[model samples]
Target: MSTLTHMKPRALNLLLLLSTLPVFAQKPIIGIFESTSSGAGDNQGQPGVRVLFYQSGRQWRSYNAICQDEACLKTIVHLYPPVTTWTLFKQGKPVAKVAATTPTAYHSYSEIGVQTITNPAAVLHLERRSTPDYPDRPHAILATNLSHLTDPDNWQPAAVFPLDLTHVIQAFHKLYPHPKNCTQNTTNSPSNYHDSTYPDSQIKMDSSYLSNKTNWRMLQITLGGYLCDGPPDDAYVDHWFAISPTGEVHHLGRLMHLAGAADFAREGHSELLFQVQGGNEAGYKLFYDNFTHQAQDTVTYH
Candidate 1:
């Protein structure tokens, strides 16, 4: 009788479109979500959201191959942890859910690996979505209660305006010659000293275009200025570009500046989480790539 009421109707619409698709077997944990305070310009010394987290061993070995049986796995608080909970994306979905006590020896330091997330309701959900009418940047993505859809928003931004690195720093000095510091000046001239230069764009990167080619656009290049006057060590030292939708840039790294950017390794594109300011303040940096076939996120954060 149960089998009789079945079949037909395009096989039940192809079994309801195969249930609904999108599962990918869990593997998607790349986190970094700073809370609020200071963003009207000057003095962004945020002293609220703490309980760190670097958590990026190539997205915990590509999602630890869907858990390798440790009695089913799900309790990864840190220290010998590989996968458990990290469902706190923004601009995509899944508002809050993070865990990692930060235990490291530095094996996946694409940006100096060392995971941590104190999690106090994600600092009261980033202070009630940064009330007072929500301004814009304090690494803001604010607004979320989170109670469903586990993991789903890829951090959308393939093209929305922003790609002017003032000429990709002469192809980043002929594609990598980064050595000659002590302020001789000439890495875009921030002096031999770098404490600040960020003109903005500390957030916007979710790339993976191994030739998927839509013109390869993933940028956050801010040229700005900060001629090393002393004591301001981290502003625009963060340059990550990949223009070419007919523009052509492609540098990829300078590091520093970014509180969040995910896709972790769900491999749809995204793996950037930088937040290590002036002389390692708690430390964190994971760049990760998929522009072609380059891997990162654990080269040394030890």
Candidate 2:
């Protein structure tokens, strides 16, 4: 009876050892080539590239290589274990080779350039191109030179005045009954130009203008003397108009204004210190009022 008890315990230990043996004996399956294609001509379209991927435990590994012909096949064979390697058969014969490094391990995959892969698990593809006229694409357009303004950061839509066209025209007519003609040049030609008798004040109007495919009924308001030699105490004003395709014109006023004083002595000549402020309707109104007051004060005092 005692001998039987000792034998039972020994038998249980032997069974446990046998159960754990399979876990370590299990080999990783490796070097499985997932995809391969034939070599086409000089290899532009198809030069023989194979992509492979495999899993070991929880981690994944991949490899990419140029497989031109049989020589490439031999190279792959050297990398993978011989007995477990499986040749990727295209049609009836082996086009490429694959093998498991161990019992369940798989090889890895990778590639260069844009390529697409589709399988039950996922689909991925990529394309490369360029866009030129994209609005957000950086470009510069100048208030004076659109081409120079090609730098996106520097370009701004032309400014408008604070007062609308109807109001601005009325104001100008009241201030200067006889409007003067503008110089015949690219920007001002065919448009009426007027200069204030006082060097510090001036106003000009352009009846026809076009921008961003829309015709503009335009106005130019200049305050402060061009000949003042230094910055003006007041600001300058700009106004814009947009005419629709139906010949309907709308006044978009007070586009921009420049203000503040210049340091004349520091730079030898009086330099205009200017600030560009506002694009919205309220902004235009504030700028127009500021410039108008400055111009009126200068006219009255000088």
Candidate 3:
């Protein structure tokens, strides 16, 4: 476990040799997400879920991320929760509806701390309550699911939420209800020249810039990246904010058609260089400095 920058000559040569060898990357998993609703109206605690779309042998299973711990970090599996019913809608018209013979829940005997559902579609509209304390808040999928991963002709902005002046967390949700039909991003964007620094898989990237070069660390959200499938169908958005060293939260503007971060600098103590798609500043480069907690325009291409 060595950082790439500090590798010895032999190690660097070995790494380069390995790179030229043919290696197959894992295929993208299809389903999984954080719980948005918990049968209750008000959700609580740190969001801890690792919903999985994977294959166990020849059987395809859904490892739904559910809570089962005193600390709330540990997870448990519910294998093949009975598909009680199936309702179909065609062109927004109800076509057919059916139900299963028996309703049940199968708890796994494995203490490995994982849940698998044989019926992958059962949890399509699933929600769960982590504890009785947060009875009103149902922890479930906040955005769309796998089914909506479509092409440009098939997809559009299913919903939008606004970020206003008030520091109230509840206000943001009032403007934009949690995205229900969107899929949760599962891949961690790589930070390298050869590999992409952005996520590009069936499940996209749901990232928060938790820490960076400035050492301005706290539990405050600064930057968030949400993505859609690539180009023509390339739908993406970004949320920006600033957290002072003393713990003050400053909400910045949201980029509607954010392209990508073109460049980032650590020499100046972590600066973000990116682009946007529309409005008066159509082709301008926005340089955001993490040390000063401010964003300034560096170049104008419009």
Candidate 4:
């Protein structure tokens, strides 16, 4: 038998009473230290200390202990080599057995059993629950397969092509078969030829009132060459036309350039003729100044 020392009288009495409990009827008496690391100079600290209760092959026990030293704290936790049984007392009687085992030698503890659940539907539901919707919303245009241009549900008929003075004149001539040579009387040489008083006056004319000198109503046609040859994806060329009141049309001119506008308005006439090409076929308004014989302003198709 191992002799016990320094046993307090009260502790002995309590131990005797615990021995008489029903718990000791089935197993041998086991001793346990309620606290460890209490000795002098053992700066083993409280961090590595733990209280454990468990059972042996046939008895219950409990104890508290600290890791060997400060340096071995991490190693002791990793190794967990110590495992002990526990004793339980109820009303001063032993009543149950508590068993524990340390799979790791440094950190003494019993292995905990964990059950993994894998249900496809449940997992998918959980994933969907965790996912967000507002931030990940789909694009409106991407929701449908049909393009906005072709989709009848959202289709809108575009307005008819806008018509300008030049186009109106052309259309009028095309519709109403105007005589090629209209008869009209002409004066040989007007006294004030440059005077604004004779605004609509006509000069020398041939047998047919149509002056052979120069018809200011003549329309000029021009084709703009390739501005760029690539797929026209991001690039475009501006095709411009300048028509003078004298019926002389100049093509491939930049309508926006002041020089081009000057060239078109230098000739005194009733109207300034111009056209734009590239984006869409639309008519544009041309403003003319009778006094300056120049185009004052223009309103283009959007």
Task: Score each candidate by Cα lDDT.
Answer: 0.38, 0.27, 0.28, 0.24
Worst 10 residues of 3 by lDDT: 37-46
Q: Between the candidate structures 2 and 4, which one is better when assessed by TM-score? A: 2
Kindly list the per-residue Cα lDDT of model 4 for residues 1-302, writing each as its tens digit: 32222333443443455455573343222221111112122221110112222223322232222222233322222222233343333222333333323222222111111001111222222111212453221111100111111111111122212222255234333332322211222232333122111111111111111112223222222212212223221111222333334544333222221111111112332222233222322112232342122212111112
- The best-first sequence of candidates by lDDT reads 1, 3, 2, 4
lDDT of 3 at 183: 40
| lDDT by residue for model 1 (217-290), tens | 45554333444444323323555665565667766555544555454445455544554433322334445453
Clash statistics: count for each candidate: 24, 47, 24, 22
Runs in model 2 lying further than 4 Å from the true structure: 1-201, 205-208, 211-216, 221-230, 233-235, 241-302
lDDT of 3 at 139: 23
Cα error, residue 88 of model 3, in Å, equals 50
Greater-lDDT candidate between 2 and 4: 2
What local lDDT score does residue 17 receive in model 1, on the 0 to 100 scale? 44
Per-prediction TM-score to the true structure, in the order listed:
0.25, 0.18, 0.23, 0.15
Candidate 4 whole-model C-alpha lDDT, 0 to 1: 0.24
lDDT by residue for model 2 (228-299), tens:
222222234454433333434443444333221211122221111122233111111111111222111000
How do these models rank on TM-score, best leading? 1, 3, 2, 4
